[model samples]
Target: MHAIIQSLCSLWQSSWQGMVMGELKYRKGSGGSGPYRVSASGRRIVRVSAVSPSGERMDLMLFPAAGFAVGGRKAEGGVYWHTFSADEVRQYSASVGDHNEIHQTESPIVSGFQIAEAMEGLEGKQDFRIRFHYPVRSGEAVSLRSEGKTVSGMTDVLCFVWEAL
Candidate 1:
Protein backbone atom coordinates (compact mmCIF):
# COMPACT_ATOMS: atom_id res chain seq x y z
CA MET A 1 0.00 0.00 0.00
CA HIS A 2 3.04 2.29 0.22
CA ALA A 3 3.06 2.97 -3.51
CA ILE A 4 -0.68 3.54 -3.53
CA ILE A 5 -0.44 5.93 -0.60
CA GLN A 6 2.39 7.90 -2.21
CA SER A 7 0.43 8.23 -5.42
CA LEU A 8 -2.60 9.38 -3.47
CA CYS A 9 -0.55 11.95 -1.58
CA SER A 10 0.88 13.39 -4.78
CA LEU A 11 -2.55 13.59 -6.34
CA TRP A 12 -3.92 15.27 -3.24
CA GLN A 13 -1.05 17.73 -3.23
CA SER A 14 -1.66 18.77 -6.83
CA SER A 15 -5.39 19.09 -6.21
CA TRP A 16 -4.94 20.77 -2.85
CA GLN A 17 -7.75 23.19 -3.57
CA GLY A 18 -9.98 24.36 -6.34
CA MET A 19 -7.94 27.53 -5.75
CA VAL A 20 -8.14 28.39 -9.44
CA MET A 21 -5.83 31.39 -9.63
CA GLY A 22 -3.88 32.59 -12.66
CA GLU A 23 -0.77 32.82 -10.42
CA LEU A 24 0.56 32.84 -6.84
CA LYS A 25 2.03 35.58 -4.59
CA TYR A 26 2.46 36.77 -0.98
CA ARG A 27 1.26 40.17 0.31
CA LYS A 28 3.41 42.07 2.79
CA GLY A 29 1.24 45.17 3.20
CA SER A 30 0.01 48.33 1.45
CA GLY A 31 2.04 51.51 1.10
CA GLY A 32 1.56 54.16 3.74
CA SER A 33 -1.24 55.64 1.64
CA GLY A 34 -4.74 54.89 0.48
CA PRO A 35 -8.50 54.92 0.44
CA TYR A 36 -8.75 55.33 -3.38
CA ARG A 37 -11.93 54.73 -5.34
CA VAL A 38 -11.76 51.04 -6.28
CA SER A 39 -15.34 50.29 -7.32
CA ALA A 40 -18.98 50.87 -6.54
CA SER A 41 -18.86 48.22 -3.83
CA GLY A 42 -15.33 49.03 -2.63
CA ARG A 43 -12.37 51.43 -2.72
CA ARG A 44 -9.05 51.48 -4.67
CA ILE A 45 -6.92 52.85 -1.78
CA VAL A 46 -3.67 54.00 -3.35
CA ARG A 47 -0.11 54.96 -2.33
CA VAL A 48 2.92 55.72 -4.53
CA SER A 49 6.20 54.72 -2.92
CA ALA A 50 9.44 54.60 -4.92
CA VAL A 51 10.50 51.66 -2.71
CA SER A 52 9.64 49.46 0.30
CA PRO A 53 11.38 49.00 3.66
CA SER A 54 14.61 47.23 4.57
CA GLY A 55 15.62 44.79 7.32
CA GLU A 56 16.95 41.29 8.06
CA ARG A 57 14.32 40.21 10.58
CA MET A 58 11.36 38.31 9.14
CA ASP A 59 8.96 40.41 11.22
CA LEU A 60 8.54 43.07 8.55
CA MET A 61 5.52 44.99 7.27
CA LEU A 62 5.41 45.64 3.49
CA PHE A 63 7.42 44.62 0.44
CA PRO A 64 9.71 46.91 -1.53
CA ALA A 65 7.36 47.63 -4.44
CA ALA A 66 5.58 50.54 -6.09
CA GLY A 67 2.24 51.44 -7.66
CA PHE A 68 0.29 54.15 -9.53
CA ALA A 69 -3.29 55.35 -9.93
CA VAL A 70 -5.27 52.59 -11.65
CA GLY A 71 -7.40 55.30 -13.13
CA GLY A 72 -6.82 58.12 -15.65
CA ARG A 73 -4.59 60.11 -13.37
CA LYS A 74 -1.66 58.67 -15.30
CA ALA A 75 0.39 60.65 -17.72
CA GLU A 76 0.18 60.14 -21.50
CA GLY A 77 2.56 57.48 -22.84
CA GLY A 78 3.63 56.60 -19.31
CA VAL A 79 1.29 53.80 -18.22
CA TYR A 80 -0.80 50.74 -19.18
CA TRP A 81 -3.35 48.28 -17.73
CA HIS A 82 -3.22 45.09 -15.58
CA THR A 83 -5.23 43.03 -13.13
CA PHE A 84 -4.63 40.53 -10.26
CA SER A 85 -6.32 38.55 -7.48
CA ALA A 86 -5.97 38.15 -3.71
CA ASP A 87 -4.90 34.49 -3.78
CA GLU A 88 -1.86 35.68 -5.72
CA VAL A 89 -0.84 37.88 -2.79
CA ARG A 90 1.21 36.26 -0.06
CA GLN A 91 4.24 36.17 2.25
CA TYR A 92 7.67 35.49 0.74
CA SER A 93 8.68 31.84 0.34
CA ALA A 94 5.12 30.76 1.04
CA SER A 95 3.58 27.33 0.51
CA VAL A 96 3.46 26.00 -3.03
CA GLY A 97 -0.34 26.02 -3.07
CA ASP A 98 -3.36 27.78 -1.64
CA HIS A 99 -4.77 27.67 1.96
CA ASN A 100 -3.57 31.00 3.39
CA GLU A 101 0.17 31.00 4.00
CA ILE A 102 0.08 34.07 6.17
CA HIS A 103 -2.73 32.73 8.36
CA GLN A 104 -2.81 29.01 7.50
CA THR A 105 -0.37 27.88 4.83
CA GLU A 106 3.10 28.85 6.07
CA SER A 107 4.75 30.72 8.95
CA PRO A 108 3.11 34.06 8.08
CA ILE A 109 5.44 36.30 6.09
CA VAL A 110 4.61 39.53 4.17
CA SER A 111 4.33 39.65 0.34
CA GLY A 112 2.14 40.28 -2.71
CA PHE A 113 2.23 40.71 -6.54
CA GLN A 114 3.68 44.13 -7.27
CA ILE A 115 3.57 45.68 -10.75
CA ALA A 116 5.95 43.44 -12.63
CA GLU A 117 6.47 45.95 -15.39
CA ALA A 118 5.36 49.33 -16.66
CA MET A 119 5.54 50.72 -20.20
CA GLU A 120 5.55 54.28 -21.42
CA GLY A 121 3.29 54.15 -24.52
CA LEU A 122 0.76 51.80 -26.05
CA GLU A 123 -1.83 51.77 -28.85
CA GLY A 124 -4.35 48.96 -29.05
CA LYS A 125 -7.97 47.91 -28.50
CA GLN A 126 -8.06 48.09 -24.74
CA ASP A 127 -10.53 45.90 -22.88
CA PHE A 128 -10.29 46.89 -19.21
CA ARG A 129 -10.24 50.50 -18.02
CA ILE A 130 -8.40 49.66 -14.81
CA ARG A 131 -5.37 48.35 -16.67
CA PHE A 132 -1.60 48.65 -16.52
CA HIS A 133 0.79 49.18 -19.41
CA TYR A 134 2.52 45.82 -18.91
CA PRO A 135 1.66 42.30 -17.80
CA VAL A 136 2.14 41.25 -14.14
CA ARG A 137 5.22 39.03 -13.95
CA SER A 138 5.38 35.80 -11.94
CA GLY A 139 7.12 37.53 -9.01
CA GLU A 140 5.63 40.97 -9.53
CA ALA A 141 2.47 42.84 -8.45
CA VAL A 142 0.86 46.16 -7.60
CA SER A 143 1.04 45.96 -3.78
CA LEU A 144 -1.65 47.15 -1.39
CA ARG A 145 -2.95 46.69 2.14
CA SER A 146 -5.70 44.64 3.81
CA GLU A 147 -8.47 46.16 5.82
CA GLY A 148 -9.77 45.27 9.35
CA LYS A 149 -6.83 42.88 9.65
CA THR A 150 -6.85 39.12 8.73
CA VAL A 151 -5.06 39.57 5.37
CA SER A 152 -8.32 38.63 3.60
CA GLY A 153 -9.93 41.87 2.42
CA MET A 154 -6.70 42.83 0.64
CA THR A 155 -8.42 44.99 -1.92
CA ASP A 156 -7.05 46.46 -5.18
CA VAL A 157 -3.65 45.29 -4.01
CA LEU A 158 -0.85 44.84 -6.56
CA CYS A 159 2.46 44.05 -4.82
CA PHE A 160 4.37 43.47 -1.55
CA VAL A 161 7.76 45.18 -1.00
CA TRP A 162 10.17 43.21 1.15
CA GLU A 163 13.68 44.30 2.21
CA ALA A 164 15.52 41.67 0.21
CA LEU A 165 16.34 38.04 -0.48
Candidate 2:
Protein backbone atom coordinates (compact mmCIF):
# COMPACT_ATOMS: atom_id res chain seq x y z
CA MET A 1 0.00 0.00 0.00
CA HIS A 2 2.91 2.36 0.68
CA ALA A 3 4.33 1.87 -2.78
CA ILE A 4 0.90 2.23 -4.35
CA ILE A 5 0.22 5.46 -2.50
CA GLN A 6 3.67 6.78 -3.40
CA SER A 7 3.05 6.12 -7.08
CA LEU A 8 -0.39 7.76 -6.87
CA CYS A 9 1.09 10.79 -5.16
CA SER A 10 3.67 11.04 -7.95
CA LEU A 11 0.91 10.91 -10.51
CA TRP A 12 -1.12 13.54 -8.62
CA GLN A 13 1.85 15.87 -8.32
CA SER A 14 2.61 15.45 -12.00
CA SER A 15 -0.94 16.38 -12.91
CA TRP A 16 -0.93 19.33 -10.56
CA GLN A 17 2.12 20.66 -12.39
CA GLY A 18 0.30 20.50 -15.72
CA MET A 19 2.67 17.78 -16.93
CA VAL A 20 1.84 14.35 -18.19
CA MET A 21 3.10 11.27 -16.36
CA GLY A 22 5.72 10.83 -19.12
CA GLU A 23 6.83 14.45 -19.01
CA LEU A 24 7.61 14.64 -15.30
CA LYS A 25 11.18 13.63 -14.40
CA TYR A 26 12.10 12.08 -11.05
CA ARG A 27 15.33 12.01 -9.07
CA LYS A 28 16.15 8.98 -6.96
CA GLY A 29 17.16 10.43 -3.57
CA SER A 30 15.90 12.06 -0.40
CA GLY A 31 16.18 15.81 0.55
CA GLY A 32 16.90 17.16 -2.92
CA SER A 33 15.80 20.04 -5.16
CA GLY A 34 14.32 17.82 -7.80
CA PRO A 35 10.83 16.98 -9.03
CA TYR A 36 9.83 14.83 -6.01
CA ARG A 37 11.20 12.36 -3.49
CA VAL A 38 9.68 9.85 -1.03
CA SER A 39 11.23 8.83 2.26
CA ALA A 40 10.43 7.10 5.54
CA SER A 41 12.35 7.85 8.73
CA GLY A 42 11.66 5.07 11.25
CA ARG A 43 8.06 6.25 11.37
CA ARG A 44 4.90 4.46 10.36
CA ILE A 45 4.14 7.32 7.96
CA VAL A 46 5.74 8.20 4.62
CA ARG A 47 6.33 11.68 3.23
CA VAL A 48 6.60 12.93 -0.32
CA SER A 49 7.96 16.31 -1.34
CA ALA A 50 7.22 17.67 -4.79
CA VAL A 51 8.09 20.89 -6.59
CA SER A 52 6.54 22.23 -9.72
CA PRO A 53 8.40 23.98 -12.56
CA SER A 54 7.30 27.34 -11.15
CA GLY A 55 8.85 26.52 -7.77
CA GLU A 56 5.66 25.78 -5.84
CA ARG A 57 6.36 23.15 -3.20
CA MET A 58 3.92 20.51 -1.93
CA ASP A 59 4.51 18.10 0.91
CA LEU A 60 2.31 14.99 0.93
CA MET A 61 2.15 12.31 3.59
CA LEU A 62 0.83 8.77 3.35
CA PHE A 63 -0.35 6.94 6.45
CA PRO A 64 -0.89 3.52 4.99
CA ALA A 65 -0.87 1.89 8.39
CA ALA A 66 -3.21 4.48 9.88
CA GLY A 67 -6.37 3.20 8.28
CA PHE A 68 -9.71 3.37 10.14
CA ALA A 69 -7.72 3.69 13.36
CA VAL A 70 -6.67 7.34 12.97
CA GLY A 71 -9.69 9.27 11.70
CA GLY A 72 -12.07 6.37 11.32
CA ARG A 73 -14.61 7.64 13.79
CA LYS A 74 -17.93 8.85 12.44
CA ALA A 75 -18.67 12.55 12.30
CA GLU A 76 -21.49 14.94 11.47
CA GLY A 77 -22.89 15.02 7.94
CA GLY A 78 -24.15 12.55 5.36
CA VAL A 79 -22.05 10.17 3.34
CA TYR A 80 -21.20 11.58 -0.07
CA TRP A 81 -21.52 8.91 -2.70
CA HIS A 82 -20.18 9.07 -6.27
CA THR A 83 -19.88 6.82 -9.28
CA PHE A 84 -17.86 7.13 -12.48
CA SER A 85 -18.45 5.58 -15.85
CA ALA A 86 -15.92 4.28 -18.38
CA ASP A 87 -16.66 7.16 -20.74
CA GLU A 88 -16.28 9.65 -17.92
CA VAL A 89 -12.97 8.03 -17.09
CA ARG A 90 -11.79 8.48 -20.68
CA GLN A 91 -12.82 12.09 -20.70
CA TYR A 92 -11.03 12.80 -17.43
CA SER A 93 -7.97 10.91 -18.66
CA ALA A 94 -7.80 13.09 -21.75
CA SER A 95 -8.27 16.22 -19.70
CA VAL A 96 -5.50 15.31 -17.29
CA GLY A 97 -3.27 13.51 -19.80
CA ASP A 98 -3.16 10.43 -17.57
CA HIS A 99 -4.03 7.21 -19.37
CA ASN A 100 -2.87 4.54 -16.98
CA GLU A 101 -4.12 1.01 -17.60
CA ILE A 102 -5.73 0.87 -14.15
CA HIS A 103 -8.32 3.33 -15.36
CA GLN A 104 -9.62 0.64 -17.68
CA THR A 105 -10.89 -1.53 -14.84
CA GLU A 106 -14.57 -2.47 -14.71
CA SER A 107 -14.83 -0.18 -11.74
CA PRO A 108 -12.19 2.30 -12.92
CA ILE A 109 -10.02 3.97 -10.35
CA VAL A 110 -10.83 7.60 -9.53
CA SER A 111 -8.32 10.34 -8.95
CA GLY A 112 -7.81 11.70 -5.45
CA PHE A 113 -8.28 15.22 -6.74
CA GLN A 114 -11.65 14.22 -8.12
CA ILE A 115 -12.60 12.64 -4.82
CA ALA A 116 -11.64 15.78 -2.91
CA GLU A 117 -13.59 17.87 -5.36
CA ALA A 118 -16.68 15.81 -4.67
CA MET A 119 -16.69 17.08 -1.14
CA GLU A 120 -18.77 20.24 -0.81
CA GLY A 121 -17.34 23.64 0.26
CA LEU A 122 -13.67 22.73 -0.42
CA GLU A 123 -12.87 25.61 -2.70
CA GLY A 124 -9.67 27.52 -3.49
CA LYS A 125 -6.09 26.54 -2.62
CA GLN A 126 -5.96 24.08 0.25
CA ASP A 127 -3.49 21.39 1.23
CA PHE A 128 -4.98 18.01 2.10
CA ARG A 129 -4.24 14.29 2.23
CA ILE A 130 -6.65 11.51 1.28
CA ARG A 131 -6.51 7.73 1.71
CA PHE A 132 -8.54 5.41 -0.47
CA HIS A 133 -9.12 1.89 0.78
CA TYR A 134 -11.18 0.65 -2.15
CA PRO A 135 -11.49 1.49 -5.81
CA VAL A 136 -14.68 3.29 -6.87
CA ARG A 137 -15.38 1.46 -10.06
CA SER A 138 -17.00 2.87 -13.16
CA GLY A 139 -20.43 1.66 -12.10
CA GLU A 140 -19.89 1.15 -8.38
CA ALA A 141 -20.50 3.78 -5.75
CA VAL A 142 -17.90 5.30 -3.42
CA SER A 143 -18.85 7.31 -0.40
CA LEU A 144 -17.00 9.89 1.74
CA ARG A 145 -18.20 10.77 5.21
CA SER A 146 -17.24 13.82 7.23
CA GLU A 147 -15.51 13.88 10.58
CA GLY A 148 -16.20 17.23 12.21
CA LYS A 149 -14.96 20.19 10.10
CA THR A 150 -12.66 18.05 7.97
CA VAL A 151 -13.67 15.18 5.77
CA SER A 152 -13.11 11.71 7.16
CA GLY A 153 -9.93 10.00 5.96
CA MET A 154 -8.52 13.43 5.05
CA THR A 155 -6.13 15.58 7.01
CA ASP A 156 -5.98 19.33 6.47
CA VAL A 157 -2.37 20.38 6.78
CA LEU A 158 -2.29 23.68 4.83
CA CYS A 159 -3.33 25.41 1.68
CA PHE A 160 -1.96 23.96 -1.56
CA VAL A 161 -1.54 25.98 -4.73
CA TRP A 162 -3.05 24.03 -7.59
CA GLU A 163 -1.68 25.10 -10.97
CA ALA A 164 -3.94 24.31 -13.93
CA LEU A 165 -1.45 25.62 -16.44
Candidate that scores best on TM-score: 2
RMSD value for candidate 1: 18.1
Q: For candidate 1, lDDT tens digit of each residue in 1-165?
A: 112112212222222222111222222333444232111111122221211232101111121122332332222221223333334344211232224233233222222222211111221211111223222333223333223321111123432221111
Worst 10 residues of 1 by lDDT: 55-64
lDDT of each: 0.23, 0.39
Q: What TM-score, over all chains together, does every model reach?
A: 0.17, 0.45
* Candidate 2 Cα outliers beyond 4 Å, as residue runs: 1-49, 53-55, 58-77, 117-124, 153-165
C-alpha root-mean-square deviation, each candidate: 18.1, 10.8
TM-score of 2: 0.45
lDDT of 2 by residue, 59-151 (tens): 444343223223333333444445667778756655554445555455555544444444313423334444444334465444444444444
Local error of candidate 2 at 160, Å?
19
What candidate 1 gets wrong by more than 4 Å, as runs, is: 1-78, 91-165
